[model samples]
Target chain A: MPDLGLEVLIKGNNLGRLLGGLWIAIEISLLSIAISIPLGILLGILMTRKNRLIRFLTKFYLEFIRIMPQMVLLFLVFFGTTRSMGWNLPGETAAVIVFVMWGTAEMGDLVRSALLSIPRHQYESSESLGLSRKQTYFYIILPQTLRRLIPVSINLITRMIKTTSLILMIGVVEVLKVGQQIIEANRMSSPNAAFGVFLVIFILYFVICWSVSMTARYLERKWS
Target chain B: MDFAYIERVLPLYERAAALTVQLGMEGILLSIVIGLVCALILYEKIPVLRRIVMIYIEVSRNTPLLVQLFFIYYGLPKIGIVLTPEVCGVAGLAFLGGSYMAEAFRSGLDSVEDIQRESAYSLGMNRMQTIHYVVLPQAVSTSIPALLANIIFLLKETSVFSAISLMDLMFTAKDLIGLYYKTTESLALLVIFYLMILLPVSIVGAVVERRVRYAGFGT
Candidate 1:
């Protein structure tokens, strides 16, 4: 067994780089969630519309997003679009765009499901009180939907953070990529450095996700 | 639709699709086995093993499969633990899928009533015998829908293997697009290929879910 030196991991500014990469992951996730939530709610509402054409369009979009892999979506936005359309998007910008697109579809499905799960009596009660359709949704439905949405959206945030690792393939300097770089740089000094670096990456990811899950649970209990 | 171009690329994509299906099958099998074993250990309440399994699930579920794949592929080589791209891909999928499957199975186990175990014990069955004959059989039946959905999710995620140079369907589509610069055609073909595989799995999942619910499993 190769001895993995902890001293090497802590010294030489490696800690700072790792934290920087983690912050980038967090930033991308936040931006994607910010854009996805409202867009997803709107699309989800449209999906439930009585109109055939609008419902079909929304369903098609949802299915298309669900069927495609995130990696493919990333490739389409980062590589195919720029090459085909002469649009020079930065790697981070491309990552966020793809993430939001993916997140919106996922969140839309969640929102639609949550909305459907609400007891129809709530809508009926609002209607009997002379509430308009829009007011019924806002005053009666949306708050309950928001409660259910919180946990699932937090799960999605965790997913987005994890998925951000894929951006490293397109040359973004995220945590995993930084770990790879550090391992590559120190390959000669310690051949087993890669395993050590990855252990750190795994621990970092575990902390972030476990905390989010705890927060989701807390919110669920509090809201319920 | 350009039949000529599609016809030329059809064989390549078909071969790649076969590989994707193979990977999905092998990965799902391995994950389910590992996941079931982990769930069993947890259910049995093995001392240190339970904590270790929990940590494994937590870590694997939290991280992205792509990073895990890269770590297994590129990172492992630096430590003289080299795995071929295909092995790395399957291992990554199994590790990630196993975590989700473990959770599903655990939930399934929880859903099994405590009285059933007591009844089994009253019938003079040993612990292992009771679990294998009574608890696990019912758990497996109830968890079928969750397992199927998890497997399909694994199948979709297998597309990420294209990045590590696996000759999966997505890789074939990427190569074709790179060569022909026909973005729409390549993506269209790839989308159809995925639907052909995923739609059946999804239908099966829905059917199983409905069956479980009808059986009073409340799924």
Candidate 2:
């Protein structure tokens, strides 16, 4: 507060607005992740399928998502879709759509790599034990995949949270947008409002991600 | 299916594509330098400085690149430091790339065993010689895939430049859209332009990763 002198957050309704913005960011990220993980995992597993067509389609989607920026994706879903398809989606809905799409691709890639990291001998041993493909995947491969996947997938969660900030560009009134509004409102009295607001936003982000990473470390050890 | 508008905008797209490449490459190179320096500092492990470096890495990594860009571009002026959009965009990207690159570099350096250093000393190599002749090549080779991937990620991220009017591919696409209002077709073209760059880099990334793996620790 001394360095930033942002106590004006207490003087007006700006505090509530900032908190509400944080809440919306959290809400969107949480909902999107909830929706994405299961579907992404399925896509990841299906990516490893022996069917050439399945791999081809999954690869196409992954490559598309991988190369494109999330900002562009946001524009595509928010502005492009409405312009083209006449769906007239809300900004928040468009934000969720973009996050879910991006998250699923990221998580799918994580799952694929975790699956790839399984030592070949493990699969061989399972095959030698007369396990069917489904049994091998279910009883053998999946548990290890999940264990490896959990630690790495924590990365995607934190990443989604951070990327949610970009929703502001698409006119979603998220935390950064809230900070902007706060600063704009008080710029006459406080020229340094943005400095304080961004510093706080940075701290909030650090805390959220730091805790997530700590839990990831704990899970890695626990699973190990 | 419709080429008239795309044809009209082709020159603008080409100019923006060139600028994107320049920005991305410059950002990538600077970040590699920053990452190497920061990683070395972290490796040497000064107490207070190490703590500061860790905080920088964590804050940069945890916060969104957009916010970082905004802070650098918009918030800095409040403190009487003004930067052009191009400068801010590139620096912001460098910071982002540098943080991740530092992580990769540290792990790469750490993977070089102390025993290797000991062996180098036994072979009459000095510290610098050992690091140069033994450690760095091994470390760089092992981490090449990660380093390349981060560069690609950074390149993709430069699309955020569109927001700040940095005149990159996304910016050009936005201009095209502003003119023609063909959001669907033009945005797809934007993605295509990115794909043209990224897909080959990724293919090379995969090839290098496999060769590095097959070549083993001698690499």
Candidate 3:
């Protein structure tokens, strides 16, 4: 086995760089979530509209988002926009845009499913109880949908974090990108840099996602 | 959209799209085999083997697939085991998909009632026969929708192979974008190609999903 550089990353500028990259990943994910949640809720509601034209358009958008890979979406926004409209987006901004698009679409789907899963009788009960339309949604429907949304949304967040690793391909200096730079930097002195650095990164990601999943389960229990 | 450029590159896009489908199908088969093997071993409760399979499933599930691909493709070379990008891509997707499939199978198999196994054994079925005659069929049926969903997911995931420099559809788009320097046409062609392949399957998936889903709600 080759020598390990586990020590090299534990202190100094290397650690800082890795943490900064982690921050970028977190920033992009959180920002995208903030944007997507409301938009996704709106999209989900619009998708359920009785208007045929509006429903058809929303379904087409949802299907289009569903079928394409997130990476392709990133490429579309990053290169396609730059070439076509000259947006000249930075890598981080491009990552955000693509992730927001994906997150919104995914969250919209989840909301639609959650809303669908609510038994029609629950809506009828609220109506029979003389609840207003807005009151019915706020009191009975949205809460149930939000409960189902919690675990799935958290799952999506983990996915968003994992997918953010691909942003390095487009030149965003996220955690995976930092690992690459570190591995490339000490390639001579530390032949096992790839193994060690990536192992740490992998463990970091695993712990976060595992905890998120666990919390999802916990919330499921608590809410139920 | 640049209509003329897109039309000119239609053949190139077609070839690339074919490759993407090939990889996706290969990934599906590979994942199913791994999933079945792992699920069976875990189901049978092999001593140390079960733990090893569990570790493989968890690690693959928890970590990002991009990192896994990088570790295998780039990291392994340092230890003198170099692999082609295509090999790395398929292997990575297989491992990732298998981990997911194993979870699906595990749950599906677990949900199957124990009485069926008892009846199978009582009917003079041996251990293997019991699995073959009774448990396996139920597990497979329960898991079919999840498996099909995985196949579709794996198909979309083939795009990630582009990160490893695999010449799947996404890389073809990336290369074309670099070559033509006209993003809208090349990128749009990529989307249309994927849509052509995935749309039909997704529609079918939605119908099956609704049937399976509502079947659960039968009161």
Candidate 4:
């Protein structure tokens, strides 16, 4: 048998450091998710409006965000704006900003589709019952929309959490970054540290994302 | 923002863009093959292979490509398996995209009515002929939107190829930005190049989706 270099993780403070890094990634995504939900609801409502310009703008923003990869957006926010605007933005701040922009667009789209999916007859039936506009929305439309949105938004949460891993590339010192640092420190002592460290990071990500997606699936099954 | 700077970096971006497209196309093709194989295995309900494919789909779908890239590029060498960065990039994309493509194909396959397969069998067609002549055409037609979306997705994911030191578009933009501090110029060019590569594909995908709907293939 050979040295697997798994010991590097047990070596003092290494695993702790990785966990701390994971916390940062989690913090960024959670912050964006918190901010995104309300703003996304607003954007979603705006997207469904009959106005032409608002529709065009919302459509354009969605398409533009969809077309641009999040990595490029990260680079643009982290590196591009700092120099161009002379603003000193931290890596974590830039990560959150970009993630918010992305999450809002995605969440907004999800909301729009969910709202559209409500049949026209539902609204007609509500009006026939002599419910006020606000009452109809509060009573009928919102609840169904919430049901459709919950599972999908849970999926977006997982996507955001997984994508936060890319923030390491911008020097955010996230889990992957911390893992790389440990691997570098132990390179002479542990030739297999890369394998060990990356495998651990991969498992860490898998566990978090897997649980989130599992929740989404459970809700989808229960609801449908 | 800077016209002259953009002009100077245009050649670098062009070369990198070519590599990105090449890598993405190769990865998409490979992923389709891998995905189709897995989907078929699941569709046939192969006992042991079904379990393995299910596990593969879950693991790959849950993990990020960045970590997967790190594993293959850095970790595999530890156990005496070495792959060039280009190879690793393609492998990573295929690994990530394969699960998605498999899900898409599996859904399409599931949507095909069982009555059609039985009809083909009653007409004296063998299993292979039934699958090839009756099932696949309808399955693939229904899967067109998902497959096209996956293709665009795989292409966008190529941005992370820079992590493995592939000289792809993202790498070129970062290199130029670092050297000149011309962030706007570099990033703008990066976005333009990506759009050039992706926008047409999406437009074509939309057109194809519309055509398929009109042609009543999936229905």
Candidate 5:
């Protein structure tokens, strides 16, 4: 039948290059995750506060992040800022910034919802038990909130990982970019290299994200 | 940002925005149809089709739309199934949007009570009639918020259309910047055009959600 061009994947150092691209994507996502988690927790706590200005500001932040496409954010940071602000920002660094911003907003919202979901009675009972405010949070609220947050955070982690694929647009040599490079190099030798390379890249993304999501599902089921 | 440059480029952004809306709408409509069919198949537990739909949903949901677009636009030509960039863009959007829409509709379908179906049956209604007259109304009403959110999401996702060489808003902004190096003006206009497109939708979605919440239809 037709040449599927699957052989291009195993040709020379192509497979290794693809894997290296995957690692770069993972590197950006992992960096964003490590930074956003703590900052997001703080933002989430602030979200649950009763202060009017704080609530409004946090809500605005969340809505802004929600409305803007991550692609635009990436472009603004990578292309716009370097020229406008006169700062030499690399694609990887710009990606981290945008991702951290997006991730923190998402994670903060998750935290706020988790915190709010704790029954009012739990708080009332905690207060009546004469525990200090800090102690009440430490002993009662944190545990429940953490339990609710873990599965969703894991899901967000997978989302972050998947979205890292967009970084390739800003000229970052992520996995998708590397796949393109391989396809371009093999264009003459393998007429169908694009199909084969993209298919493999798709599988790589699927495997990583599918495993991460499965873990989240498992946690959700185990806890529920 | 340069005011003169912004003024001159306004028409271009406007045209790009119109195209973005057009393609996004086409994709969203197609996706809604696809999603409903998938949701119905899943809800009905239609044997092998149900398993296939499940696989489709998981695969679409897990993968980024960018890669899917690349495959459709670049990869498929190898096998003689070439599609235009615009078609590929819309197809990619629909492919991803379909899974999400299916999820929203499936949740709505699941929320329909078995008792409602039994009552409909007792009244001499067939399965199809019961689903059409009784189940869909309530399920759709409850699913309004989710469907609206998905619509907005799908609209925002149109930004990625530029990657495939579609002259959408993102493409316009990037082209202007590349040609003139007016990065701030191009990006500022990009943000404004996007806000002009999305903000109204967000506001309208909220209003519709509120209206549906109070309408108490099917409840």
Candidate 6:
């Protein structure tokens, strides 16, 4: 009877806690992407400039972010920078900052690739129509880029949402952290609760990511 | 920039780098085996098994590697399934890497056109033999670039093990930053360490991608 009651508890409050954590994960990921996509597009355009130095600097920044682990980047921005510079940042703020930085670099690369994939004929046609370079980008290149960018950007969003689990280490009360807390609290009372909690966490993540992937596939098929 | 601090920490960083490399290599190896097996199971198209593998891959791929590590390291011990930190770290990485690798291989498998599969069958090869001798070899070649990129991604991700108290290069850097407060220098060195490892891997991936492209598997 006691065991049955415990199972009921897991299926109820435990499930609710998992859902709450997932909400925070989605919130953070969307916020980070909201900052990253526009910044990345602007940076991507700056990176393609004819000026040599801007190209070099943007290339350097992209490569730096690419090679470093996001966790280390999180730690650097959250812990080291705050301590060294005497600036205070909440854990979620730090997590978002690091993710936005990482997300921006990746989005920049995707934008660059999308831009490069645009046919030269389109640019020429737009120019022949007497559009300025700025107008060509705004009216011609940008729309096509957005069409191609949607799938990759959605993939990035999924990545960001998954990666936010790391913010728990820096003390954000996200899903995984909440799972850990619940497992800890119930360890003595319920021996199997830890695995049960983790299983729930895993399922929650799978559902969110699976839906996002389905959306990406739908977008890809529609656009194609 | 202090020579004394560099001298004091160089050996520690080197040792940690060696451990990091070892962990990355072991994790990649394990992941390849696990991923290949899981991929083959899905390729076989068995009903229940395919569904299970799909669920496994999706869950593993969507979750953060750090969260996975913590779950294994902290959560498992509470269940009396204690693993050493190194073992736990490697297992976590392998699980995460395996999921992505399975996706890469599945995409590779998808690239082999249906016409080829029909031709292989017409040649009287059994399904397993057809996959083994025809589809898989081509799929592997087509997938090498993506596989290598995932490997590099996995290598970068192994740095997350430092958070769980693994003595990886990132861990060493964190320790130095803690002790000496040389945040800039320590982090710069860690960045260099990552660059040195990843640059070569990226070049290799690029070379493989070019070759794959030249082979006319553009799709």
Model 3 lDDT on a 0 to 1 scale: 0.83
The fnat scores of all predictions, in order, read: 0.54, 0.65, 0.71, 0.77, 0.71, 0.51
Clash count (model 1, backbone only): 0
> Positional deviation of A177 in candidate 5, in angstroms?
0.9
> Which of the two candidates, 3 or 5, achieves a greater TM-score against the reference?
5
Instruction: Name the Cα RMSD for model 1.
Output: 2.5
Model 4: CA > 4 A from native: A125-135, B215-218
Worst 10 residues of 3 chain A by lDDT: A3-12
RMSD of 3: 2.7
Quality of candidate 5's docking, in CAPRI categories? Answer: medium
In the range A1-224, model 4's lDDT, one tens digit per residue, is 66667899999999999989888998999999999988887788789989999999999998898889999999989998898889999999999999999999999999899889999899899999999988987899888898889999999999999899899878899999999889999989997999888899899999999999999999999998
Poorest 10 consecutive residues by lDDT, candidate 3 chain B: B210-219
lDDT of 1 by residue, B3-78 (tens): 8888888888889999999988999899999899999989989999999999899888888887788778766775
By DockQ, the candidates rank as 4, 5, 3, 2, 1, 6
Q: Chain A TM-scores, all candidates? A: 0.94, 0.88, 0.91, 0.94, 0.95, 0.93
Residue range A5-119, candidate 6, lDDT tens digits: 2362355477788789879878999999999999999888887788999999999999888878887788789777887789998998998899899989999989988998999
**In candidate 6, which residue ranges exceed 4 Å CA deviation?**
A1-22, A183-193, B78-80, B121-124, B216-219
Task: Chain B TM-score per candidate, please.
Answer: 0.97, 0.93, 0.91, 0.97, 0.97, 0.95
Per-residue accuracy of model 2 over B56-146 as CA lDDT, tens digit each: 8887888878878877877677677899888888899899988899998988898888888899999999977997898888788778888
Per-model clash counts, in order, read 0, 0, 0, 0, 0, 0
Stretches of candidate 1 exceeding 4 Å from the true structure: A1-11, A83-86, A186-192, B1-3, B217-219
Model 4 earns a TM-score of 0.97
Give the worst 10-residue stretch by lDDT in candidate 1 chain A.
Answer: A1-10
**CA shift at A170, candidate 2, in angstroms?**
1.4
Candidate 2 local lDDT, A62-170, one digit each (tens): 8888778888898888878998888889999999998898888888888888888899888999999999988998999988898888887787788888888877877
Query: Alpha carbon lDDT of residue A24, candidate 1?
Result: 97
DockQ of 2: 0.60
* DockQ leader: 4
